[model samples]
Target: MSRKRLYLRAGLYAEGRSDYDFLLPLLNRLLSSLASSLFPGACDVEDSLGIDAPYPAPSERAERIAAAIADRRAECTLFVIHADGAGDPRYARQSCLDPGIDAARRASPDVVTVPCVPVRETEAWLLVDAEVFRPWLGSDAHSALPAEPEREADPKLTLGRLLKVKEGRMRRKPERLYRLFGEEVSLEALRALPAFQLFEAELVEAIRAVARSQGWPR
Candidate 1:
């Protein structure tokens, strides 16, 4: 009997450059967990294509998605698109993610696309786990976090207030802070958020679709 080998290649189009620092690690962790459960005993390899530049205008998103698909259609099995649900989650999904994903699917029907639209902003997701702040703020980290952080109008501002540093002390850069939060934040807490739950469900379905198409053992 031969052991099966599975290669999972993912492409990420983040809304901001700082998002990569957080999302890359978060996505990798999710993939690792999924692979362990879904393809136990198989040799699983993972790769990712990161889009680090500024997001294109909404009008250009479809063309950009199609071009990205064309560029790595052979290697990429999944594409995760990030769009901040600022003010209106519905509008963001319709205007920012749906059209692009539809166009991409039309061009490369085999590839699976997942939308990651964090309510308000990605910072909202980081606010769910208060323990993630202890390392930076010590006992003073006991500030009250929002009950429903996703509904907060400006989660970034709220996070900044909670993590404020004293004058003359150097503050951690946003990218590094986001990466730290990503690595340490509890996934269980994240799942409590409606937006995160939706994203995770879609991601799981996308992975299952890819696995079925590839005939990889479940």
Candidate 2:
């Protein structure tokens, strides 16, 4: 029998430019991890941001998803959309993500869609592991980190304050910090979060579907 190698290509539709910086690396890692677990043989995972096409208006989320699918359908096996829960995870999923996913699938039947709705904001997920950013804080700053970041009304603001303290009056840009968090934050800590777990489950199912279609044994 000829050896089979699985090659997975993923595309991302991030909510913001900074979101791409964070989510691209994070998605790549997550997909690689999941692919390795599901495929015993050699596996390769590659990802790209769906930036070839312009996004529609923020309110036209379903259109945006359809556009992304149209743009990357040929090159990508899976498409992940990142949307901040913005204080109401259920509403975000029901009002924004589900409609978008449905439209994308309807428009491009071959496209595999995955929703990544981080509760409150993507920053909340970054806070899952304080150790990732603790070293950047000043010694005098002694404020306790939020015990439940998803419940925090504005995790981005909280993270901004910490980064400001670390950089003093210079006002550090958060994009680098987000990238750092994406690279180093512990997957175990993220898995403990309900929102992350939901994403993982959906992502795994999508990958399984792709594998089945490709005639790969799961």
Reference-based lDDT, residue 54, model 2: 54
What is the per-residue lDDT of model 2 for residues 1-218, given as tens digits with 9 covering 90 to 100?
96777778888887787788788888888888999998856677876555434544445767777776777787888888888998887888888778878887788776787888988899888777767666765453334567777888898888776666533542445677677777887888889889999999999999988887778875
Residue 191 in model 1: lDDT: 93
**lDDT for 201 (candidate 2):** 98
Best candidate per TM-score, number?
A: 1
- Cα lDDT listed for each candidate: 0.79, 0.78
Give per-residue lDDT, candidate 1, residue 8.
76
Off by over 4 Å in 2: 55-59, 138-143, 166-172
Q: Against the true structure, what is each candidate's TM-score?
A: 0.89, 0.88
Name every residue pair that clashes in candidate 2.
none
